[model samples]
Target: MKTYHAIQELEATGIVTAGITRRHGGVSRVPYASMNLAKHVGDDPNAVATNREIFFKQSRLTALHYCQQIHSTRVIDVDHTASATLKQHPEADALISAQTGVALGIFTADCVPIFILDVATPAIGIAHAGWRGTFAQIAVNTLTQMQTRFGTLPTNCEVHLGPSIQKCCYTVSPELLNQFTERFGSTIRKGTNLSLQTANTIQLTEMGLPVASISVSPFCTACRTDLFYSHRAEAGQTGRMLSYIQLTTKN
Candidate 1:
């Protein structure tokens, strides 16, 4: 079974390794089923460990730096000195790094996993964008940080919005929909369903990123439970998939 879905556009750059894991090819039992890489979801520790090891081997990644993921717009910069294990990670929703050989990861079941690759600066960022994070503009904050820390320009970046519960399956409250429409304009919502993808894309484009520079995955976790784990579809009793990106040490 395939272990991951590569972010084709990012990998095409030949400077980074990027993708999200599929819910197959691992030892995780029912609910998690298989290929679950997160340890905070009540899955067996050994199972999670084995699954992560499987990803590292398959992806040829050795070092991993991930956030604790608090559903906020907090973005952290991961430098060469930063090292993190599953048990020891910072409390944030996004991570950016210019350092090679270290994978920046985010755990998500139904939230959007935003991947940013600033080719000019050779930096990478990954963010966990749930509704709250999207509302607060986490994706924009990541780009802003990249600009400040690494001299990254939005035009030099290629971005991908990984699979999550898209608008078709992500119905929100009327109040939330109004808030999104007010912030991102009315085009981002259909009735009470908000498109987190559009909300993020609008902000990114407004910040000078061309619309063509961003690619969004068509897959919806809630719609395709066979391929992904969905918190809403699974009633909060499912494992999380890991979305990660790493800069290759090779020049």
Candidate 2:
């Protein structure tokens, strides 16, 4: 929504609508600047509401579903029956749905946003992958959940890696690096930075997802702050962008 930058492939999908927002086009100010989507990040609630409304209107989506990302392997199922009333948003890093109208949304600053659409089954999933979430294999875990919940096959799923902090701007701890190397081997290391996008792509490919269905966004949030909000790039004082997917019936 808000005419934000988006992944062209995902945008071209006829059955599902997917997009990622940028740092432009909203009421947030100063450090958060504009188009800030997260409520807990200290932006005024009314401003966030206005931004969200603009996005919702522009995207033509139904009520959005989101979660409290704990950088873990937990994945939540969102269905047509899912309700927005919650004591708190589910604490999970990924969300999956077979339902149409409803959109699955994941917020990120510099962290990775992985979106999967099972085109054959008309279902979708979205994940928030910070280093901890990646280390927990959130992408693979989400696919596994989709398989169980929607009978989604990896071959029929299209994966999109949205703008994030790539190896050029990301550095991990030695312990973290060891864990990554053990799982994906040392080829993931590009100097001190860990290639999170590549690592997740590898994990998905190893789990039987088609190589051709995966598309990685070339924009790095930290490198393209003019079009995105980057937490690490902004010294952790920045706002967040929303990466989302929706399964909508043909009009």
Candidate 3:
């Protein structure tokens, strides 16, 4: 079985590697069911470690820096010299880095795995955007951090919203729907179903990123349990897919 779904648009930039791991080809069982990359979940530690080993070996990525996600809008800036220490994962939902050979990753099941590549500055960012993070505008905050730290321009960025729970299955409460509607406008909600992808896209576009530069995945995690682990569809018991992007030492 395949180990991941590569983001071809980002990889085509020829200076980065981007992809999201799939739920197959590992040692996780039942709820996680193989290839689970997150440790915070209830999966066995050995299994999660083995799954990550399998993914790293297959992806040929040497280092991974991910945060302890809190569903907040916090963004972390990873310096080029960060690999020297064994620091605990920062409590954040987004990560931006300009370092080569280091991959930035985020875990998600139903939430969106947002990939940001500032092709001009050659920086990369990965954000985990659930309803809370989406409402908090985590994606835009990531770009803003890149702008401040790396002089990254919105027009030079190419973003990818990886596979996640879409509106077709992302039904929410009326109060929550009203909150999203008020912030992101009425178009972001379809009945009680909120479109987190649309909300993130709308925010990114408002940040001056070209509409054509953003690419959203068609795979809805909740709708495709065969290919992904969906927290909503699986009743909150599931694995997480790792969406990652790395800057390479090339043009």
lDDT of 1 by residue, 3-67 (tens): 99999989999999999999999999998889989888999999999998888888888888887
Question: Which parts of model 3 are misplaced by more than 4 Å?
Answer: 84-88
Clashing pairs in 1: none
Tens digit per residue, CA lDDT, model 2, 1-251: 35477667876878877899888889888898789988879888898888888787777776688888778889888874564522125789888889877778888998899999998887899999988888778999999999998899999988999999998888878888888988899878887789899889999999899889999999999999999999888998988898988887668
* lDDT, residue 184, candidate 2: 91
Of candidates 2 and 1, the better by TM-score = 1
Candidate 3 Cα deviation (angstroms), residue 158: 0.2
Q: Which pairs, if any, clash in model 2?
A: 28-33
Question: Which residue pairs in candidate 3 collide?
Answer: none
TM-score of each: 0.97, 0.94, 0.97
